[model samples]
Target: MDTQGIFDSSSTVRDCSTIFALSTLLSSVQIYNLKENVKEDDLQHLQLFTEYGKQLKKDNGKKPFQVLEFVIRDWQYDYDYAYGQSGGEELLAKRLEITEGMATELRELRQHIRSCFERVTCFLMPHPGFEVRKKSFAGEISKLDEEFKTALKELVPSILAPANLTPKLINGGRVTARDLFTYFKTYMTIFNSNTMPPIESIMKATSEAALLAAMQVARELYETRMARVTAGLSLPRPALQQEHVAALQAARAACIDKNKMASTKDVNESLARLTQELEALLPQYLLINDGNLQKALGEAKDAYEASVRRVHGADLLCVHPSDLQTIHNEAVAAALRVFDARRKQYPGIPDDNRTKLLESFLPRLDELNTLNNEHNRLFVADAKLSFMGEVERLLARDPPLGPYEFRNEYNRAKNRAVAAFKRRRNMPSTYYADVYEDDLLRSIENRYYIIREINRNT
Candidate 1:
C-alpha cells in the first residue's frame, strides 16, 4: 500500500474512524498506480499465505489466521509520527521530523549507491567536463558519495531476492515452489547491471584516489603564490633612482680606465690565468662561480685596450694640446685619476700577478674613485671629451651639475651588493646535510596523506 510508510500507533477509540479513512485513501492511491502484472503477483502471494498458513495451523494443532503478523514490541522501530491531536502533539511532531529526516537522508544515499555504478564506470570511459572543486548542481555528486556508504547495510537483505530463486518446498507448500521462480525473475534485472558489488570492491577497481590527489596540488600552489607576493613588500633595496645616472656612469668609466693604465701588464696576465682556470672549472663543475670572476676580468680587459692605443703610437703620450688640460671636472675624470693608464698605454702588453694583487690593485681602483670624487667638489665646466678647441673654451662650460649627489648614491649601493655576495660566499656548505633535497622528498611524502586517512577510517 502507498500507506506502507505511514503507520499510526495512537489507538484512540474516537480517532479510529479518521485513521481508517486515511488508510483507505492511501490504499486507493497504491492500487491505482499498480500495473496488472504486479497486482496479480501480490494477489498470488496473499493466496499462498492464506492456504499455507492454514495448513501449518492444522499440522501443528493450533488456531491461526492466513499469515503470521506478530508485533514484536522491542523490534518496532517506527519512523512515522504517532499522532491523534493530544497535549503532546509537539513531541510527536519532533519525533516525526527526526524519523523523516533520517529516512529521507537514507533514500538519497541509496540513490547514490545506484548512481555510482554509472559514475564508477570503466576506466576507458570518457569523463564529463565538470570541475570537482565545486558541485555540479545541488550537491548531487557529493550527496551521492555520502549516501552510498549509509545504504550498504540496508541493501544486504536485497541479495536474498536472488537467493530465493532456488527453493525447497516442504509438504503441501505449492506456492513456495512457484514464488522462488518469480523472485529470481525480478532479481535478474538488478543483477545484470553489476551494481551489487560492495562499495570497497568498486573503489578498488577504479583508482578514485586521484580525486584527493588533485586537491593537494591546489592547496600548495595557493600557499606558494601568497608567500612570494607578500614578500615583495619588504625588500631591502630602495626604489630605483632616475637622476644622477650620468654622473655615476662618468665616474665608473674613469675608474675603469685608471685601473687599466696602472696595472696593464699585471691585469692581462691575471686575465689569461683566470680564463684558463675557468675553462678547467666549467668542464668539471660548471657553476663553480667562474662566471662571476670572469665577468669582472673581462671589463678590466676592455678598458686596458682603449688606453693603450693612445700611449703607444707617440713618444708624446698626451699628444693633443687638449690632453695637457686640467685633470678636474665634476662630470668627467682627468686622465690621472686612473693609475693603470701609466703602465698600459701601450697595446699587446699584459699585466703580471703582483704578490699583493688584491692588496695593491684593489687600493688603486679605490684611489681612482677618490680622484673622481675630488673633482666633483670643483665647479668646472662640462668638458667635451674630444681633442678640440681652446682650453679656455673647454673650462668655461657649466660644471658637473649634480656629480657629488649621484656618485655617492651609486658607491653606497655597490658596496652593499658586494657585501651581500661576500656574506653568501662565507656561509657553511648546505651539502653537509643536503637539506634542500631532503625538504623536496619530505614534500612528496605529504601527498599520500589522503590514502592514509582512508586506511585509518577502515
Candidate 2:
C-alpha cells in the first residue's frame, strides 16, 4: 500500500545486483531454484548471487532472497589482441615491453662501443711493425770525431772553417776522416745533433709511438668487453642469453701491463669512466623497462576479463523460484492450519455472528502465517483491500490467479462503490465510504444466501 516503501525495497534490490556485477569473472546471472537440484553451472551463478545478497543483508540486516541484477562491460587490448579476440594479451605486451626496451638500450651502448673500436684500429698502423730504432744511434765516435782536430782543420781551409761553410778534398776522390772532420768544424763537437741528428734517436721516438698505439688498442678492446658485460647485466630477467663470452675473452686479452708501455694513470682512468657510465645508466634502464612491463600486465588482466561481461542480458533476477517455493510451502502449511481451525469454529457459531467472526479473523490469520515468510522471500503480491482505487482495480482485473468463484462477489461490490461515488459531488466523501462499507456488508451477508433465493412463488 505504501508506494515509497515499495520503491525503497526495489532500489535495495538494484543495489545488491550492481555489487554482484563487480565480479571480474562471473559470466552471467541465472535464477536458481535452491529447492531443486541445480546444475553445477547454475549453482556457480546462484552462489555468487547469494554471497552478494548475504553480505548486503549483513551490512543492513533487513531482508534476504532478493532480486539482484548484474551488468558486464567488455574490453580488450589493442596490440596484444585483435578487436574481439582472447588470449594472454597482457603477458605478451609485458614481455615485448621489457625485452624491447632492454634491447634498445643495448643498441645505443653498442654505438659508443663501436666508435671506441674504430679509434683503437686507427692507431695500430705504422707502429711496432717498423723496426725504426735508427734515430737513437750515436754517430761513429772513433773516426768521425777527430777530438783534437779543431785547430788542425782550421788551417786546412779558413774559408771552409767559416760557420755554415763546407769543402771537399781533391787528390784522392774518397774523402778522409780528417777532411770530413774539417768539413764539419763545430758539428764534430756539437754534442746533441752534430752532423745529422742520430738515427738511434728516431728509433727511440718510433718505439715510444708504437707503444702508445698498442695502449690505445688495448683500451678499446677492454672497453668493448665492458660494453658486452654491461649489456648482459641490463638484459631482462628471463631473456638473458649466454653472456657474450667472446667479448669477455677479448677484454681479458686487452688488459695489458700498462706500466711497461702506457700511462698507468690513463689505464685506471679508462676503467673508472667505464664503471661510472655503467652505474649511472643501468638503474634507469631497468626502472623504465620494468615499469612498462607492469603496465602491460595490468592491461592484460582487463582484456581477459572482458569476456565475462559480454553475455547475461539483464532480465530475470528474483528470489530464485526454488527458494521462493520453499518459503511458500512453509507459509501455506502454517496458514492452512489457522484457516482450518477457524473454519471449524465458524460452523459452530450463529450465522450472522460467524460472518463477522471470520472476516475479523481471516486477515490476521493470513498475516501471522505470512509475515516471516514474506521477510524470508521478500516478494509478495497478495491483494489487501485497504485502498479505494486498489479495490476497484482488483475488481476490474479479475486477476487470473485469484479464486474464480469469488470473481462475481468482488465485481458486485466494485459496481456498488462505482454507483455510490457517482453521486458524491454534493455528498461528502465519507458518504462513499458508508456506501463502500455497506457493499462489503452485503457481500458478507450473501455468503449465507442459500437455495431459498430461487422460488419467490414457492
Candidate 3:
C-alpha cells in the first residue's frame, strides 16, 4: 500500500477502544516512520552522522544508547529526504534495512551505524571528474579503462538525474532503481539522436580523458628512466668504457622516441629538452672519465713543483745573458709543457681549475726572469769597481817607476784584477767580450793618470 493508505488504515485502527494500547503503539510507529520519510535531504547531515558516530564509539562504555540516539537523530535529520515523495519509499526502506531498537553491544551498534553512513555516502557522493580521477590514479594508467567504467557506473546516475537524487537516504525523497534505469535509457536515446552521431564527441571526450591519464603515466615513467640514464651518463663506468658514448647516444635516441609518442606537448617538450641537455653534457662527462682528469691535475702539480726547484737552484750570476735567457726559456717551456700536457690529457677540466693551475707556476716564472735581469746589473758593477781598486793600488807603490816600467806593472796588475773580478762575481773570464775589454783598458789608463798626479803631489 501507498504511504497515505497505510496512514489512513492506522488512523481507523487507532479509533477502536478494544485494542487501544496496541493500536496507539502501532499508530505511533507509523507516524515515526512517516516523519522520517518526510524530512529534507541535506549534505551537512553526513558530517553530522560522522561526528555522532565518533562520539558514540568514544562513549561506548558509558551512556552508549544516548550517543546512539544522537547518531540516529542526526541521520534522520539529514537523510530523511531519501524516502520518495512519489511512492518510492518502499525501495529506499528496503535499501536501508535498518532494524528498530538498539543492539545489546555498542560495537554492533557502531558497525551498523557505520555501514549506514557508508551506504548514504556511496549513494550521494558525486562521481569524480575526469581530471580528478586521472590525478587520483597517481600516473598509473594500466587499469584506467576498468577504473573509468567503475567511476562512470557510480557517477552517471547522478549526472542523469541530479534533481531526484537526495543527500540523505534515511528520510529524504527517494530515487528508485527503476527511475535511474529509465533516466539512463532516455539519456542514451537523446545522445544517439543526431545524424552525425555525437558518438564522435563521446569518443573524443573519452579519448582525451584517457590521453590525459596516460600522459601522467608517461611523464612519471620518463622521469624515472631519465634519472637512471642521467646517472649512468654522468658517472664513470669501467665496464662500459668502450661503449659509453654509444650508450649515451642510444639513451638519447630512446628519449627522442618517447618524446615522439608523448600525448601532451608539455611531456614531449620536456623529454626533448632533457635529451638535448644530456646530449650536450655527455661528451664532457665522458672525456673527464676517459682521461682521468683528476690524475692529470695531480701530475701537473708535481711538474710545477719540480720546475720551481730547478729555477731556485740555478746560478743566475755565472750564466751569460744568452744562458740566462736559455734557463728562463727552459723553465717557461717546462711549465708550458705541464700546462699543455694537462690540457691534452684533461681537456674537459673546468676553467676555474685551469686558472688556478696556471697561477701556481706563472708567478715563479716571472720571479726567475727578474732574477736574471738583476744578475746582469750586478756583474757589470763588480767588474768596474775591481778595475778602479787595482789601478789605485799599483800607483801607490813605494818607489815610483818610469812610464815603461809603470806600463808593464799596470798591464800585469790589470789582467790579474780582471780575472779575480770575474771569479768574485761568479762570471766566466770571457764574459767580458772584446769591446768590454777595450772599455776597461781605457778606464784603467784614465785612473792610472789620476793616481800618478796624487803621488806627485805627495
Top model number, lDDT: 3
User: By the TM-score metric, which is better: model 2 or model 3?
Assistant: 3
Error of 2 at 42 (Å): 99
Candidate 1 lDDT, tens digit per residue, 8-32?
A: 3655422432332222211211111
lDDT order, best first, reads 3, 2, 1
Error of 3 at 78 (Å): 69
TM-score of each: 0.16, 0.20, 0.33
Candidate 2: global Cα-lDDT? 0.32
For every model shown, the clashing-pair count is 17, 12, 12
Candidate 2 lDDT, 159-240, residue by residue in tens? 2345523222111122334433332332223222323223233223322332343334454664455454443223332221
Give me the displacement of residue 296 in model 3, in angstroms: 8.6
lDDT per residue, candidate 3, 1-458, as tens digits? 11332234465432222122122111211112222232323222222233433443353321111111110111232233331221233324443344567344433533544443323222222122355455466654454444344534644453347663333111112223433333334334433432322423433332233233333333444445434443422222433232444554455454444332233565555556555654565465456544554555567666655654564454544444444445545655675566555443223433454556566666765665576456654654677677667667766777766667767777787786556544543334344453334555666667777666665564
Give me the runs in candidate 1 sitting further than 4 Å from their true place.
1-290, 311-458
Better of 1 and 3 by lDDT: 3
- Specify the poorest-scoring 10-residue window by lDDT in model 3: 64-73
Ten contiguous residues with the weakest lDDT in model 2: 118-127
